[model samples]
Target: MNEYIQRCEALIQELPHDAVRQNEPIYKHTYTQMGGLADLFITPTTYDDTQRVLKFAHRNNIPVTLLGNGSNVIVKDGGIRGITLCLKHLNNIEITDTQVVAQTGATIIGASREALAESLTGLEFACGIPGTVGGAFYMNAGAYGGQIADVLERVLVLTEEGDFLTLGKDEFEFDYRKSVFSKKQYIALEGTMTLEKGDVVQIKQKMDELTIARETKQPLEYPSCGSVFKRPPGMFAGKLIQESGLQGTRIGGAEVSKKHAGFIVNVDGSTASDYMNLVRHVQEKVNETFGVMLETEVITIGEDLKDPVND
Candidate 1:
């Protein structure tokens, strides 16, 4: 057999599942329908498989990238090299009397619905949030005055060295938009959230109010990276952009949403470069007008199409 075939066989032996793909298109997974390809894409079927993949990649000195739900990330057009891990299949949510356990791949919105079904009260704020539980935990994602850190009790993670451990809320050091996961680059496996029993009617009412508020205030009709900028201290990012006359501005196919200045939406086919350019333009204009430089909440990854090495 040729060297390429032999190498493929060896890696497959280590991966031990059919959930692996070569040259996988990443745009299909993202909310904005952007991105190019991933050289090697893996959706592990179990926690054991995830550990195996991480350990194997580490042993072989292969670079590994993590993608969850793809709600707030922009992958450049040149695509990602090495192994890209997307744990979309290891999603399982279990609800108990006083808590809920969600595997990292499950959507936070789905988890909130499960909690509401059990008459739980703590997750009402997350009912309209996009992204997975892993993403939520990674960035301490929140909305409508509630954040994941408040309801989260602990988490299971695989360290960079391929060791598994559980960390409590305090260990996470949850801040405004970050956790230990963001600081230490830990791959979250699952999470446990402590909750309280509430009246189902009341829980649904709260969720409905938040959903309507989100749908009304945000541009949910288009594909976009939900919120592009962090809230400046004592100020709102959207309000600043709107006041600066940046709303409806377009860079290529990416446009600052006229409906909500906080969002950059893909009205047509948009590249990551286009999105980033628009982000920069909005920042420059807002800063020039009000001296408040907006900071990006969205994560950007992958390589540019113009990179010579990629050619």
Candidate 2:
């Protein structure tokens, strides 16, 4: 084995046997079923374990990648190098009255359900967001006039230097699908959501209504990274793409969703390259027609594309 691979294996032995894996396929962990292999994939089950792995990587000068539920991201075909940490095993939820404390790995939908069980009302808007608590907090995810910023009270995070810290709501700087987390190298550990007590029937009705709307509007049957581009100022990205006549435009295996022009879906064995090309094409067309530059909301990682789209 090479020196780096040997060191990775030695480090894996220090963690729980089942928690660490070598050359694991990253495609299985993502929503779009894309990506190559990760040289080292660690599924830490506890906060301490997460800290240990991060510390080890930091000391060894190894690259570390933080991955949540893999909803709003695209992993390149060349995959990721070094340690890719997945916190899915750290999932835990607790409710005390109108406050909900959720680990980073817990799904936002799961947290919303816990809120519904406790008859909390504010999280009904998040029941349909397909991401983890950490991912939601990282992006300030929102829909239907409700956002994580409206309910989030505080968050616990581990900084790049391995210090644990708690940040209050005001410190988060939550805006349209953005947070201060985007600017910092801190990893979210857990979040506390403050909600209001409401009638169970009313909350369930709202959640159900939003769920129906999502099913009717989004291309749920296909694999996608969810809303490829951010809303550009006063304009909606989907409307602009649709107006540019770019809906259902295909590049390789990736196609803009006919149902929602904002989404790029894996129609037939699409690679990360296919998705990016389609995104660029739509951007060019929309810019040419409407003169608005669309910015990508989806996070792209790993090596550069081998076959890039031609202009």
Candidate 3:
């Protein structure tokens, strides 16, 4: 084996019990059902293990990337360059009084359910958000007219130097699908949320209503990355795409979802390139029709889409 591969294997062998993976398929890991292979995917069982991995990577100048549930990102066909640290093993949820403390890898839906079980409100809006706690906090994820900024108290993040720090809500600088962590290079470790005591029945009712609304409106049956674009202020991204008559637009395997204009789904034999082509086409058409540029919410990373090979 080459020196680099040998080093990675050594590290993997010594990795925490929670952090074990080799040649793992990245496609199965994402919501989009795309991507290639990860050289080494590590899921640290504890914060110390996570820190140790990061420290080692930093010391060795090894590249590292943070990945959550793969709800909002697209992995390159070439895969990641170095160690892909997955926070999935960090999943943990705790409730004390009106507070909810959870590790970064815990799903937002799970956290909301925990809140409901505890009769704590303020998280009903996130009942259906398909992302991890750390991802949601970093992006200030929102739905149904509420956002993470509304209830976030503080977040625990790891510095690039492997130090942990607690940042308060104000320090987060949350604004419309963005946070301080989003701009800065920091890894979320866990978060503490402040909620309110409310009638569980009412909270559950709201959650159910939103769930139904999402089910009725979104194309959930297909493999997709949720909304492909962010709301463009004063105009919904879906509405704009629908108005531009861009729905059902297809470029190879990927198509602008007929059910929801905001989604780009893998219809059949779709590739990452197909998705990218459709996204570009939608942007072009929307810009042509409305004089407004539609910004993508789905994070894409891959090589240039190769032209289709003829039969």
Candidate 4:
């Protein structure tokens, strides 16, 4: 084995055998079913285990990447080199009256369901979101006029120095598809969301309506990184793309969804490059047509191709 791989394996040996995997395929983990591989993939069962792995990587000067549910990201074909820590194994949810405490890996949908079970109202807007609590908080994910910022009370995160800290909603600096977590590189460990008591029937009705709206509007049948771009100012990204005559535009296997122009879906066996190229093409067309530049909401990472396709 090479030096880096050897070192990573040694570190993995110190953690639970089932928790650490070598040369793990990242494609299967992502919503788009695209990506190459991770050099070392670790799934910690608890917060302490996560810290131990992070501490080891830090001390050894090994690079570390945090992944959550892989729902809103596109990992490139060249793959991630250092250790990729996926928090899926840390999923745990607790309901205490009007509060829901969710581990980082717990799905936001699952948390919303827990809230519904407890007849809490504020989380109804999140029932259709397909991401983990950490990812949602990282991006300030929201829909149907509600956002994580509206309900999130506080979050627990691990700092770069391996220390745990609790941050309130204000500290998150929540905004449209952004949070302080993106800039600070703090790994979210857990979060507590506060909700108000409400009629269970009303909560379920709202969730159902949202779910139907998503099903009718989005191309959920295909693999995609949800919405491709953030809303540009007062204008919607999808409307801009649609108005630019870019809907159903295809570059290789990736295509702007006919149902929703905002999404670049894997119509056939699309690669990360195909998706990225399509994104660039749409951006160019939209910019030329309307003087607005679209910003991507989907996070793209990993090595760039040696000879990437022209955008």
Candidate 5:
């Protein structure tokens, strides 16, 4: 084995029942169907294992990136440097009286479904969110007028100091598509959500209705991130882009969805560059016409292929 791979393998041995991959294709892990290779990817099976990996990375000064369901990120084609930590193996959901405890890798949709089965309410808004608990908490992801901050009681995170701490809702500092946890770059391990007992039939009904609404409006059939841009203040992002006459606009193989202007879909075999360029094009044109800056909700990583504005 090479030096870096040997180092990662040694680190892996310190953990229990964890898997590691060298040069894993990141595109397969993301919703956008675009990304370069990951130098190293590891999924730990237990909290202790997760902590051990982090401690090792911290001590060695190896750069680490935490990944969830890969639903809202755009990785550049040049690939990622250092270790990419995936929590997919940490998925677990347990119920206790009024609260539900879940690992970071557990899907929000799965959590919402469990809520319905347990006759739990207040999590119906997350039935359609395509992400993990950690990702949801990091972004304060919400829909249908409900957000993570509304239901989250506390979160277990691994601090940079190699200590585990429980942060309450206030500590998270939830906002529109942002959180203090995100800013602090803390690694989330588990979440404890407080929900209410309600009628299972009613909860299921609400989830069904929301799912139908999403299906009718959003392009779920195509491989794309859920939303491309955050809603600018005082204006709906999709409406503004649509009104700016950018629907069906194309940058290489990427195109703003004709059905929903807020979406930048890979209509063909779009490279990461294509999608990013399309995003900037829409942003610039909308800003020029409406005098409103459209900020991206999509998180971008790695080096740019070219300056987007010039394309």
Candidate 6:
């Protein structure tokens, strides 16, 4: 047997207690409900298991891809190579006074709800965001004029070297839809958010208002990668798409949402290529119309589907 094959088998045996599946379909894990497979999809039961898996992958030179809630990522049809570490089982949210601590796998919505339960005021903006805490920190996720940068206190990240490091919010170099964790390729384990003690009624009211607004505006019923494009310099991406007449534009099964121009929805069974192609088309049309090049907020990973060879 080849050394790589030997390593794969050995790693599986090492993590016997973890939920490890080989050549597993990843579509079910993502919000968009489309993907190919993961060579080794692992959901570690404990933090120690996470560390051990990382150490093993590092020592064996096996690439490890850390996924949070899979809310904003696309895995191509060719599938991912090596290990795919899903942190969904590590969900733990702690609240003390006005500060909230959330693990990587904990949903931002869940964290916000916890904040509301405690009468905290800062996370109300995130009550409708469909990403995990780690993802929110990685991308500085924002909505309703509030963002992670506004309340984040610190982050705990796991390095490629298998060491944990704590970084203050200021150290992240936070900006619109970006943070240092993405650039550094660090795996964020958790985040601390500082908030204000507020009246429960007011907290609930704000959260309810935002929830109603989100439900009213977004195409929440369909499978979609929430907002497909980043807001370009003082311009709303959805507005630009609407003005460009790209709404309801369909390529294969993927369509630019008529309800929300910023989102591309899977109206039928759509491949990653369909979504990708539609995104490109929207970018081209919007640029032609308004002279502003649009950037994507959604992330695509893995290889493209290869065309079949015929004799």
Clash tally, candidates in order = 0, 0, 0, 0, 0, 0
lDDT of 3 by residue, 1-311 (tens): 43444677657767764466766778888888888777677888889888887787888877777889999887766566567888998899999999999999999999999999999999999999999999999889999888999888998988777788889977998888788987876899999999999999999999999999999999999989889898998999999999999888899889989999999998896777677778899999999999989988877753443346841
Query: Model 2: clashing residue pairs?
Result: none
Task: Sort every candidate by lDDT, greatest first.
Answer: 4, 1, 2, 6, 5, 3
Pairwise TM-score winner, candidates 4 and 5: 4
CA RMSD for every model?
2.2, 2.6, 2.6, 2.2, 3.0, 1.8
List where candidate 2 sits over 4 angstroms from the true fold. Answer: 2-4, 305-311
Kindly indicate the candidate among 2 and 5 with the higher TM-score: 2
Superposition TM-score, candidate 5 onto the true structure: 0.94
| Every model's TM-score | 0.95, 0.96, 0.94, 0.97, 0.94, 0.96
**lDDT (Cα, tens digit) per residue for candidate 6, span 1-311:** 43433577876787754478877888888888888878888898777778887888889899888777788988887777788888888799999998999998999999999998998999999999999998999899999989999999898888887788999966999988888999888888888999999999998999999999999999999998789889998889999999999999999989999999999999999989898988999999999999999999998887776778941
Go through the candidates in order and give each one's C-alpha lDDT.
0.89, 0.89, 0.86, 0.90, 0.87, 0.88
Report clash pairs, candidate 6: none
Assess candidate 4 and give its lDDT: 0.90
**Candidate achieving the largest lDDT:** 4
Q: Compose the digit string of candidate 1's lDDT tens values, residues 212-251.
A: 9999989999999799999999999999999999999998
Candidate 2 TM-score versus the reference: 0.96
Better of 1 and 6 by lDDT: 1
Say which prediction, candidate 1 or candidate 4, comes out ahead on lDDT.
4
Candidate 5 lDDT score at position 78: 62
Tally clashes: model 2.
Answer: 0
Q: Which ten residues in a row have the lowest lDDT in candidate 1?
A: 1-10
lDDT of 4 at 295: 91
- Candidate 3 lDDT for residue 95: 99
